[model samples]
Target: MNDNSKVLVALLAGVAAGAALGILFAPERGTETRDKLNDALKNLGDTIKDRAAEEIDNLSSLKEKIVENIKTTLGAAEDAADQAKTSATEPA
Candidate 1:
C-alpha cells in the first residue's frame, strides 16, 4: 500500500481503538454499551468502504491518463517517422 493509504489505515485503527476503549469505560449498562459500540463500528465500516471506493476511482483515473499519454507519444513518433520517410523519397 502507498504511504497515504498506510497513514489512513493507521488513523482509522487508532480511532476504532479509542472509541472502543471509551465506550468500554463509560458507566453505562451492558446493553447500552454494546449498542453504542455496535453503532460506532458500523459507522467506521461505512467510512472505510467510502474511502476505498474513492481510492479505487482515483487509481482508475490515473491509469487512464497514463495510457492516453503513452498513446499520444507513440502517435507523435509514428507521424514524425512517416514525415521523415516522405522527405527522403522526394526528388531534389
Candidate 2:
C-alpha cells in the first residue's frame, strides 16, 4: 500500500469514529438514532466501494502503460540492433 492509500484509510477511520461518536451522543430517540447510524454506515460502505473501484481502474491503467512502454523500448532496441548488424555486414 502506498502512502496515499494509508493516509486515506486512516482519515476514513477517523471520520467513521467521529461520526459514530457524534451520532451516539446527540439528543435523539433511540430508534431514530439507530436508523441514522445504519444509514451513515451504509453510506460509508458505499463510498469505500466506489473508491476501491476507482483505485482498481487506476492500477489497471498504470499496468497497461507500463506494458506499452516496455514493448516500445524492446522494439526500439531490436531495431537498433538490426541496423547495427546490417551496417557491419555492408562493404566499407
Candidate 3:
C-alpha cells in the first residue's frame, strides 16, 4: 500500500491499543468504556479516509508532472536531431 495508507493503518492500530488499555484501567462502567472505544474508532476511520484522498490527489499531480517532463525532454532531443541533419546536408 501507499505511504498514507500505511501511516493510517499504524495510527489506527495505535489508537485501538490505547483505547483498550484505557478501558482496562478506567474506573467507569463497561458500557461507557465501550462507547468511547467505538467513537475513537469511528473518528480514526474518517480521518484515514480524508488523508488517503489527499494523498491520491498528490500522487496524481506528481504523475502528471513527470509525464510533462518526459515530453519536454523528448521534444528537445528531436529538435537537436533535426538541427544536426540540416547542418550535415548543407554545402560546406
For all candidates in order, the CA lDDT equals 0.98, 0.93, 0.87
What candidate 1 gets wrong by more than 4 Å, as runs, is: none
**Candidate 3 TM-score to native:** 0.74
Best by lDDT: 1
Clashing pairs in 1: none
Top-scoring candidate (TM-score): 1
Cα RMSD of all models vs. native, in order, equals 1.1, 1.4, 2.8
Q: lDDT tens string, model 2, 1-92?
A: 89999998898888888888999999999898899889888988988899899999999999999999999999999999999999999999
Q: Which ten residues in a row have the lowest lDDT in candidate 3?
A: 2-11
- Using TM-score as the yardstick, the better of models 1 and 3 is 1
- Candidate 3 residue spans exceeding 4 A from truth: 1-11
lDDT of 3 by residue, 19-89 (tens): 87987689999899888878877887788789779888999999999999999999999999999999999
Candidate with the larger TM-score of 2 and 3: 2
* Stretch of 10 with least lDDT, candidate 1: 1-10
